[model samples]
Target: MLTTLIYRSHICEHFPPHDLKEMVNAANLKNGQADVTGILLFNGVHFFQLLEGPEESVFNIYQRICEDSRHYNVVEVFCDFAPHRRFGKAGMELFDLREYEREEVLQSVLNRGTSKYQLIYDDRALQFFRTFVEATEKENYFEIPPADSWAFVSDDNSVQSASLPAEITTECSFAFQPIVDPLAQKTVSLEALIRTSSGEGSAAFFSGLEGDEVYKADLKSKKTAFALAGAINVGARTLSINLLPMTLVRIPEAVNFLLEEIEVNGLVPEQIIVEFTENEVISRLEEFTSAVRQLKAAGIRVAIDHFGGGFAGLSLLAQFQPERIKINRELIRDVHKSGPRQAIVRAIIQCCASLEIMVSAVGVEKPEEWMWLESAGVSHFQGHLFAAPAFEGIPAVCWPEMLSAM
Candidate 1:
């Protein structure tokens, strides 16, 4: 299968057009030899590159690029096992902004699929791409005019990033969604979900970030979740924070910041749950495992989000026995009618039970689905049936009337 990786990095210094082209030419010859393909877009400041090929070839090339020292603060924004290559075997087709029309290149970026870009780059991301292309065409690369942006200007701290406006109170906010333990007749935790104060979806809310902007945004989100959880009086309830595995590897000290926030909020580290996507690719599990150990040592727990998706299967569970595993929505949706889905959920529940790991079913939209999961041994649940995400403070749960009193 073809695996694709999209990475964004900061260019350490300016390279002349001829030097850049030479670099691209050499890369083209090298990648072509290995059947690797992708586009590299640079604005003399930030860069976005997409690489796709046989899994090993892509991984090998990415490692070589990472160690090359031409750039620093490299971050993997997107990666997946693609059904097929998108820009197959380009070797290294440099999207030299100088040669391409500014508007045309920007439009191509805007028109890219959400499934590929939305989760990584934000809506305004195209605008940055356009601006870079414009700068290249005008031969004004070194002088990218600064604007009011919530991007980190430096890497002085452990997160290696800091935002321009240290106090950005307007762009986004945290919304709490309840995760309930139906059998216990209580809320197991409140997962902090992101909501744009302007009331836009995630894609628009997260738009226009590149390079250190990515790290700055993630750090901001972590701090915001804890602060909001405090304001809403999470108190004794478990508070869950969504983190990207990639970000954790980049900013492992983020856990210390989280620890500080918990104390500042009069909360204990034990009440905190560090949730991460199970499907997200990690090139270095050694780094991730170290971070997880740090969290565990600090008394914070971990949960594998979207448990049934990605390359990880039972092997991952056997390797890392996280305190909890969330049943992916694909297995919970309409599980009452789908025999295969039911079987998968049962096996997961039974397997987790044997391992003494708690299982929480996510995206349970109907009572039948809940009923099925509950019968299969999922005591904790999250989804619309309990309550839709409250975009502001904690709204009341629309729990079953019979259990609301209990």
Candidate 2:
């Protein structure tokens, strides 16, 4: 969970900066033991922070923070099961808003305001504290607050909870469907599928195409780009882009270029899911992991595609720590029939869940298969039952729509 602590107090005024540094160091020592990563924000007279890590670490820090003799109007601006970790490491980063030229940017963008060291506890002054932290980070820096103007921060135990929009809680249940070959009773989406360029295609379309000449030509013909453009034109919210390890090694510039296009076309990196094949990723795990880390750092979501197909170990999973893991279709195809296979898959999913990682089953085909997967605690599914990778466009549908359509 992404836990944030907004302590609105005159603690800064009460303690000297040197003493505050010592207290922050102490806090960091406690956090390191608990494996928490967060940033501390201080605006001279006030203090606020966005903490991300295990729940226990955050809670422990909150309890300690309240005891410190800093200023008193403590508030928790945001908290939630963050889609992504905000900070890379566990440390207390101090940001002084007084340094920024445009203080209004904090107020206007994040809804946080500042005041003289005296009126630190005024309710109005505390309103914009989280906003400032969020604007500086420029990410979904906080959980969506419950209301537009105010959020409740329970001081009883420093457990911070925000009031989010009602729609946020009810909207968008995401699910996946298997990709199947209608002719082959045997599923094929589990295999590592690479993008190939065909003759008469745009250079961009052929940028990373490989494999059979015919397939390469087909991919190069601007078909995929046109299809993706069309999907966005029609309001498609997310796009899945498959990348080969060779592509990262061979066409690094092209990868950056496509990422730029994705951003230019009105999609954030978070909306573009990049899938990496096992063979490709495992061959150059370090390079692949580095690339994934960079992409993730840039807010692009990464998926270790075709997981469990190759000799990938749990160590690899720990190393990359991707936001999503798509189990190789082979694992899904015969998992129900093989106890050992099922056990391994279950273990992988359980491990991922513990890390707050999302597990998606790929290449599902039958209704019974879906039911079995759901029972196995799979959070998302993708297969032919959902839709094939077509040049037509990404379908506009919800998780329930896909499920009911099946």
**If scored against the real structure, what TM-score would every candidate get?**
0.57, 0.44
Per-residue lDDT over 78-124 for candidate 2, one digit per residue giving the tens place of the 0 to 100 score: 44564445443446555566666564535432322212322343333
TM-score (C-alpha, index-matched) for candidate 1: 0.57
For model 1, the superposed segments whose C-alpha errors exceed 4 Å read 1-168, 281-283, 401-406
Q: Per-residue error at 259 for model 1, in Å?
A: 1.2
Error in Å for residue 158 of model 2: 49
**In terms of TM-score, how similar is model 2 to the real structure?**
0.44
Per-residue lDDT of model 1, residues 93-197, tens digit only = 776555556557665643443335523344333333444445542321112111121121211211111222233268777677789876565778888887676
> Best by lDDT, which number?
1
Q: What CA RMSD would you report for each candidate?
A: 22.6, 21.9
Top candidate (TM-score): 1
